[model samples]
Target: MSVTHEQIMLTSFDEASARRALALAGEALEIEADAIRKLHARLGRDDSVPRAVALMLACRGRVVVSGMGKSGHIARKIAATLASTGTPALFLHPAEAAHGDLGMVTAQDVLVAISYSGESSELAVVLPAVKRMGVPVIAMTGKPASRLAQVADVHLDVSVDKEACPLNLAPTTSTTVTLALGDALAVALLELRGFKPDDFARSHPGGALGRRLLTHVRDVMRSGAAVPQVAPDALLTDALLEISHKGMGMTAIVDADGRPVGVFTDGDLRRLIEKGQHFGQLRIRDVMHLEPRRIHPDRLAVDAVAVMEEFRINQMLVTGDDGKLVGALHIHDLTRAKVI
Candidate 1:
């Protein structure tokens, strides 16, 4: 069929619009990437970066992060990152500092002041009081000689060549650089403090990462009567009853001392049926798989998940140091707990 004139025109317009959109996106990404590259280049030569990190490391009290407007937002995020990483920190709005919030800052603390333009008036207004309190300041600014930078014990240059915004009036590249610098500071302190994943999880208990790192097998496992279990000499039918009652798709076969010797799962029952074996006549020991996969109650649930996935099984028994069955958990339990 021949293409209509209107169809060709519409297709061309759509292609042109898509090209313009993609070009604009590419330009914006290039500008931001260049800004990051400049920051990366400066890292090797900037002695002030290490000085700031050292000062923050030596702080006996919280790091008071203060800034104005857009800088204030970045300061809050920086403070949160620091707090979560092992460095105790809090955000102090420069404007609010003039109105008694300055009391929150103590001489024991160090201050990190962020301002792309080193002349933020609100920061200027409160910085004097911070100085009077004898708190050392680390300044993040574009201008090395500006008032804020001059007053600082250490000044980190987060200056970018140009704004990512087409008009170059908005704080885009500058804010990104400032945020990146803040992250650098936090991570440096984290490394210096030997902050581990457990420490991070402690600070972020409500997050998925915290759950994965902190949740132990005992926390999610079904214990006592809820754990499907059968004596080694129990009938295969009895083991099946326990599996059905616990809904774990498996039953642990334990010895007289309550130590798990083997496990019988729904899959085992299926295999037995396929072999034309009679379930009524067999004991659990006759049909159970010896040396079932087991995990310690103290181990992380995420580790249990790895075991389950590695063995291609749906459930595992939680055993004590002596290998006695203490609990059991199905893959569904891990899924429900968001530990998978």
Candidate 2:
């Protein structure tokens, strides 16, 4: 693996090209970020945001979002964000709506039409029908005097000074502003409706927060015969065997009442060996750690994770109201359950 003269020269040229590309990327990101900031600034002074939110908040049916070209892509994303965040929303392609999908809208629904130029002919064909149905149309456009804006019930001005594109012809900054406004509308509606995390979990059951909120200790803990345990009088060898047989890497030292009094892990065995203590001279009660961390079966599994992370322990005991050991948990259990 040696570099030739041409290869070295090519590497130098590639570095310069890469630098230019990175600078361009940074500029584009900055431009998009500035557009969002401007949108945020306008939100403080503009009543359009609150008015649009009110319409959507009062809507009995889903929010029907429509756009054309690049705006259409942003509209679809906005609809997904709205739906996932408690507002019922779906994207309706303008061309498709003109063809037949306009029937999906109703008087009970709110229509959010996105067009940078506000002169999308495809959207124009469907706007009249939506207006005739008495559905409230929230127009997100760069031009306030365009046909779509004139026909809309609520006009949200999403104009940007110039696009991030070098030619200033592409829908870059304007689309970003429109999408930000869409998110602003959805967030406002959700806030006014008092939507909670549990509500969001129900909407996104497959997401990380959903798993944490919905999964319980009983659902993931090792129970019954799977829980590793030993009597206080049990021999160190016997406890070791219990831990090994259960594959929990630890065993709970229980009283005659079957309640865990202490816990002994493989770490304890290692320390005993390092101290030159013979296994024959030790009892489970003598070596085990007293009053181990424990959680209730009904508590969320995420709570268990917090306890383990705070105490820096890998295993936890699950106890019932009777103070009897019902189950055990290892960090591996959480990993396997995808709760960690």
Candidate 3:
């Protein structure tokens, strides 16, 4: 809102400043790592971690995570992790919850309140209302004797010896510990639910793992009239024309019943050209590689990628159970579909 003509100027940064910065950076990481280690040891010292997991898993509704300031950021991240990993969870801003957002918390829901000092005034108001609704509370805090922890149904101690900041006032180390504890709970619930890759994919359809798990051969394969095919008796030049028109680098040689008998590719055409053979007289069967690599339509597209990479082939045919040429796939198709 205000500006001054004065500014501190430095002609250059010296090695001493760089060294001090690097040292602090390394020390911060070490402090955070130690905090997480302490959090793990605390879990071993008590049954709070398992008890917290049990409450969340037993809940018929969502896990409502709430906190203030830096702890609030960690609360949001924890809610997202739990939701994506099979537990239904949401983040409720503490200040907002006291101002009517508390209605989001139901009697069947579990409240996860995060407060480093256990004195977040906003959460103090929400805890009472949530308690009245018969909702259980899981509190994460640095002070076990703090009011928030004392009132919680389950207490998770996320205490850290000191902050990574030189002033020992910032929440760097404590926040990392809180976030990690939340992840541990989500993963525990995930394991208990027997959540599989497909289940995770359903919730993360836009992610890479989701693409690999949910995209099927039929989804990426060129099917129907788009597949490049020529009769086994067709001329080699005709197969070449089919390959060029379809732009699949190859053409399938199918029998009268539309079953793939073989495949002729650009490599075949090159060898034919080198031999100076009469492309005009040669049939597709004359140069076709018999028994083309094939896959099922129902298989995951990632599985098709494996088959293509294993055989070192760029093109593959999709065959039905009766061995009919139902579709085709080129490596480029997988790339276009973001399945590669």
Candidate 4:
């Protein structure tokens, strides 16, 4: 068998073709960026944004997002984003709307119809019924002068100068621009509604974001007898036993008034060893870390994690408003709660 270098055996194509492809992509990106930048400028100068914002706020029911073909995919994503971000929205497929799905929309609802060319026939079929119900239509389209835009109560121009596709036919850059525009609308609505993290958490209760935003220290902290605790005057050996018994790697030391004075950990035990002092002869307060990191029971678990990170601590004592130890929280507790 003849030996051959893998590099030498590799097939080659016209290098200019690859350069041309990249050049087209770069040109398309610049064009789309310019288009979006112009749109942003328009947002600053326009009264239409306030009008759209007011109309959405005044709506008594859900937002109905509708489109056909590629626009339909974008519309569906927009609907999901709106629903997740405090705006009640649903995607209404134009083809299905003609087959009685139009009933899902009502006078109380606001319609957001997406059509890149502003000329989807399937969407047009339901326009008369939408008008009859006296519902407002917000159209997202590249051609603002087209029938859909002309018929819409509010026309949002999402026109892109070029497609990222080399052939200049496919919905590449145009789709990207439209998707960004949808995000712009959804986020604006979220801000207009004063949507807080807690509100978002309620809508996304099963996700990590929800857990971090909604869960409090009290919800995850081990309380009462579960918390490893020792008196300030207790022997170091006895406090080590309590720490081992609770398996929290540490024990809280409280003063005569039962307020947390310090914390003793296995690490503290190691230092006691280095000092050549017998555990039986020493008190927990003599070897414990004073002014230990502590968190409030009512605080968010994510905030607790931030405090722990800032102090370079792995565990914290949960305290009540009265400055008494209520619970012990390990870093793993936050991980389990998805707050990490």
1 versus 2: better TM-score goes to: 1
TM-scores across all candidates?
A: 0.91, 0.86, 0.94, 0.86
Report RMSD (Å) for each prediction in the order shown.
Answer: 3.8, 3.3, 3.5, 3.2
Give the per-residue lDDT digits (tens) of candidate 1, residues 1-340. 9999999978777977989989988998898889988998989895998899999999999999989888999999999999999999999998888999999999999999999889999999999988999999999999998999999999999988899889998898899989988998898889999999999999998899999999999999999989888898898888888989889889999888999999999999899889998666788898899999999999999999999889899989999998788999899989989986
Candidate 4 lDDT for residue 86: 92
lDDT of 3 by residue, 242-289 (tens): 999999999999999989999988987888789888876888897899
Show model 4 residue runs off by greater than 4 Å. 1-17, 41-47, 206-208, 255-258
State the displacement of the C-alpha of residue 235, model 3, in Å, after optimal TM-score superposition: 1.9
Task: State residue 154's C-alpha deviation in candidate 4, in Å.
Answer: 1.7
- Per-model clash counts, in order, read 0, 0, 0, 0
lDDT of 3 at 75: 96
Candidate 3, residue 255: CA error in Å?
Answer: 1.3
Summarize candidate 2's per-residue lDDT along 150-209 as a digit string, tens digits: 889889998887899979998888988887787877788788889999899989889898
> Each candidate's lDDT (Cα)?
0.91, 0.90, 0.91, 0.87
Candidate closer to the true structure by lDDT (higher is better), 3 or 4: 3
Minimal lDDT window, size 10, model 3: 2-11
After TM-score superposition, what is the CA distance of residue 305 in candidate 3 from its true location, in Å?
Answer: 1.0
